[model samples]
Target chain A: MDLFYLAISSTFVNNILLAQYLGHCPFLGVSKRIGTALGMAAAIIFVTILSAIFTWSTFTYVLRPYGLEFLQTLTFILIIASLVQLVEIILKKKSKALYNALGVYLALITTNCAVMGVALLITRKELGFIEMLVFAIASSVGYALALLLFAGHRERLQISAIPKSMQGTAIALVTAGIMSLAFIGFRGMAA
Target chain B: MSKTQHIGATLKAGLWQRIPPFRLVLGLCPSLAITTSAENGLGMGLALAFVVTLSNGIISSLRNVIPGKVRIASYIVIIATLVSIVEIVMKAFFFPLSEQLGIYIPLIVVNCIVLGRAEGFASKNPPLISMADGISIGVGYTLSLTLIGSIRELLGSGSWFGLRVFGESFEPLAFLILAPGAFITIGILLGLQNLFSRWRGEKFIQS
Candidate 1:
């Protein structure tokens, strides 16, 4: 029940993209197509879960023990970066289908702040291993959910004529504003 | 090349030509989250400047030793270290501001601007040039943040930096400081920038 609540809140109430503003770059940049968004979502889900566990355990065992909590930022980032690369290589060797699905996105996930944010949040919230894993999955799902909606909107936008001045990010951002407003309805469910 | 000209070019490029928010659209996650008020924006900007400047200088100095494959990791580590220092300093001195900025301080480790500069400018340039690039981009980011923050704060609070400008008759539109407000403000600013470019007969900045 605790893990379920955590997952639900992370997905809806405190969405990393709309509510928390963690991964705007990729959310905006890659959400132009449903195909790309789904791919990115799959890769992010994979990476976020693994790194959340990896960083949480490392923090609990090594950094916290040695009073090197200050190194959390440095160590966690390095871990995420390396982990993304490792996942790519291992996927390529083990499962061709999975690697092909996540190929480009696995590389792109290196700088995706949502992955790093998951690690940081897991530590900040002081969740147990199971809860942390659930939260990571939920956050990725939340991000993926938001991305799908935006990608659908952007896809529709391709056919609709927009003012030249508001063509690119301006229009996208305004849409994000509306999406943000919509997400606020989830606040009643907030913890 | 002349020293003065090189420094001037870096500053100009960073401040106006390739400003992070409007121009390059880098480091925007931080901008969106922290620009609730001018004060928070300024505080976050200062923390970013301190981190970006030091990290850029250090990365530039160590560029030669870092191998090709692991350079990105190294840059992030150096940036995270500097961000940690700034986090501690901010907590020690400006407790309230630190509280307001919250998780963003440590998240600076992944801020694209810091890593962007380290990889793009610092890794290739000398320490002096990289330091200059850092300061210039920092100033550009600070000005943009304060600008966005002030607009949101004015609309949301009917005051400038906590000073009431309207004589109590102002019922502030509360949405201006909310999550939507951040996007609205930046969106309007970006649109205006595009309109200005079109008016000036310049190439439209691609988002």
Candidate 2:
């Protein structure tokens, strides 16, 4: 039940994009089309979970035992970079369709910060291995949820009449504001 | 638009022509997340300035030595190292502000502005020029963040740097410091900028 609350709170109330602002690059970059949104979300979900797992163990076993906690930033970044490369190579060899769908986004994930944010947040909260996994999954799910909803609105927004000046980032930000307002409503529901 | 552009133009471009967080639309994450108060925004901006200038200088010097395919990785390694240094320094010297900023400080490793400078300017230029690019862009980022921070601080808390600008009975919106408030604040500022540019008959709002 505690794990369930953690999942719900992170997914809804503490959304990575709308609430925490961890993954704004991906949130705004590939969110124009629904297809691209799904692709980006899928890639983030996959990599965020894996990077969390790897960074956690590395910090716990390697860094902590050796008193290298100061190396957290450098070590976690290197871990995330290698993990992204590994995921890219494996996806290409095993699943052509998935690889094609992910495309440039896979490479971009290495710098997405959501991956690193998950790892860092995990360390900050000092969650156990299982709790870390739960947070990662929930964070990514929240990213997907917000992306899909924004993509849907953006699809309609593409056709709708917006002012000339507010065409791209300006309007997207306003939409995000409204979406964030909605997400705030979920605060009392779970946590 | 010459092959060998003047150094002044590059610096000018980052300052006003293509200022970030507003014009280039890069680094919005920290711009929004940290700008709740002027102090936090200024702190974040200076940290970025240190990281960006140092990494750009290092990357520019090593551009030829780094292989083409691994350049991105190399750039990130350099950036992460600088960020780690800043993180440690802040922890030691500026513990209060460091605690205020939290993970966002370390997350600068992946900040678009830093990497954007690397791929866009630093990789091709000499170290001297790239260092200028970093400082120019860093100053632009600092000013923009400070502007946003002061606005949010004054309105959200009815104070500037906690001085309480407004009278005691004044009701602060309070929303201006929240997550939704951040988006609204930046969005309105972007629109207003574009609107002013259009009034002046200039092409603006690149993306």
Candidate 3:
């Protein structure tokens, strides 16, 4: 029951994009096409989960035992960048379709702060290993949910007759604003 | 491009042409994350300015020595080192602000703006010119972030920098401070910017 609440709260109440705003760069940038949006969402989900696991292990076993918590940011970034590279290489060799779908988004995952934010939030919240995994999964799901919804809106936006000055990013941003306002409805749920 | 023109153009480009956050839209991570308040935004901007200028200078100075295949990795290492320095210094001197900004201060290492500048501008220019470019772009980013921060802060709190600007009548829109507020505020600001630029273009044509 507690785990269920955690999942729900993370998905909507404390949404990674709508609530915390951890990953707006990709949220706005890659949501133009549904295919690429889904691809990016999957990439973020994979990277966030793995990053949280690795960061939790490293923080608990390596950094804490040695009193090197200060190295958190640097070490996490190095790990994430290398991990993205490894994932890209493995996907390319093993699954051509997946590789083609993910394509440039795999490289982009390295810089997506949402992945790092999850790791940090998990540690800061002091979740155990299992709880950390749950949180990671939920956060990524939330990210994907927001990305796909935005992509849908953007697809329609491409055909709509928006004002000349509000075309492109300007209009997309305003639509995001409306989406964000809609997300506010989730705040009433029990966290 | 001619040498003199190249230097002059590069310096000018960072100010508006390649404005880090607004024009290039390269570094949205920090732009959205840390601009929750004017103070946080200023602190982040200053720290980023320092890192960008120093890293750009060093990268430009050592561009020839770095191997092409491994340049990105090398650049990350250098940036990580500088970010570590800023992180430590901030923690030591400005504990309160440091605590408020949280993991974001160190996360600056991964900020695409700094890396983007290194790869796009710094790597190609001389040290002095690259440093100027870095500073100009940094200023542009700082200006944009501060602008966003002030707008959010003012609307969210009915105060500018915590001084109540609007009297008791103003019931600060709670959405401006919330997560959705960031998107709405930035979106409107972007739209207004586009509108102004178009208006300016029309004026130039008429004149």
Candidate 4:
């Protein structure tokens, strides 16, 4: 039940994209086309979960045992950067199809705060391995769900007549705002 | 132009030409996440200013030493180290604000604005101009966040920086402080920024 609550809570009630506001750049940047949005979503889920696991283990086994908590930010970022590079190289060598789909976004993932945010969040919450995995998966799923939904809106928005000043990100953001408002309706479910 | 004048021009450009969160559309996370209240916005902005400025200076100073192939990684390491310093300092000195900011303080390492400035301006420029660029951009971001925060605070709670800005008869718009409000507020602000640039007869700067 606790794990269930964690999943629902992260997925809906406390959505990383809508509520917590992590990864807004891609949320706004790549949500233009449904195809790219889907690709970005898949890449985000894959990398977010992987980086979360790596950072969690590093913190638990390495940072915590020592008095190097101050180095947490530095270490986690390096881990994530190198990990993203490593993933990209291995994916390119092993699976061309998968790499081609996720390759472009892999570079962008290094700077995506959502990956880094989840890593830090897991450490801060100190969830066990299982709980941490659940939370990471749930949060990234939440991110993907938001991205897809917003992409659908943006696709239609492409045809809609928008104000001259509100043509691009401005309109997309307002759309995201309304979506966020709708997500707030789920606040009581997990709680 | 003279050297000092050229540096001044760079600083000025950072303020208006490449102003962040609006012009650059960079650093959206903290700009949207923590700007619920004026004080929080101000605190976050100042913290970001400190990080971006220091990182820009450091990156500029070492631009030649970092190889092009590994520059991005080197920049991240330098930025992450600086962010750690900011996190520790905030934790030690401003406990409540740091607590409020939570993971964002650490997440500053990934903030595109910091890295963006490092790559775009700092790597090509000298340390003095880069630092100035950092200060101007940081100040611009600070102002934008504060404006967003002030509007939200005033509307949501009838207060500005914890001081009541509206009379007792004024009913607050509670939605402005909620998750949706952050997005809507920034969305509208970005629109206004577009309109302002248009009025100035300048092309809109796409992020």
TM-score of each: 0.96, 0.97, 0.93, 0.98
**lDDT value, residue B80 of candidate 3:** 86
CA lDDT of B9 in candidate 4? 91
Evaluated on CA atoms against the true complex, candidate 2 attains a DockQ of 0.81
Q: How do these models rank on TM-score, best leading?
A: 4, 2, 1, 3
The regions of model 2 sitting more than 4 angstroms off are B1-5
For model 4, the superposed segments whose C-alpha errors exceed 4 Å read B205-207
lDDT (10s digit) by residue, model 4, range B55-96: 999999999999999999999999888888888889999999
lDDT of each: 0.87, 0.91, 0.84, 0.92
Backbone clashes in model 4, listed as residue pairs: none
lDDT of 1 by residue, B7-61 (tens): 8899788777778788878888989999989999888888888888889999999
Model 1 TM-score is 0.96
Docking class of 2: high
Which candidate leads in lDDT? 4
In the range B1-207, model 3's lDDT, one tens digit per residue, is 887787778767766566656667777767777787887888888899999999999999999999998888889888988999999999899999899888788778878889988998889888988888888888888888888889888888887766888989889887787777777777677667667768777331100
Per-chain TM-score of chain A in candidate 2 equals 0.97
lDDT-wise, the better of 3 and 4 is: 4
Q: TM-score (0 to 1) of chain B, per candidate? A: 0.96, 0.95, 0.90, 0.96
CA lDDT of B99 in candidate 3?
92
Candidate 2 lDDT over A90-148, as tens digits, reads: 98999999999999999999888788988999999999988899999999999889999
DockQ, every prediction: 0.74, 0.81, 0.54, 0.81
Residue-level lDDT tens digits of model 3 in A80-124:
888889999999999999999888999988778789788888878
On residues B1-207, what C-alpha lDDT tens digit does candidate 2 reach at each position? 663477788788887778888887788889989899999989999999889899999999999999999999899889988998999999999999999999999999999999999999999999988988998899899989988999999999998876889898989989889899999989988898888888888876565
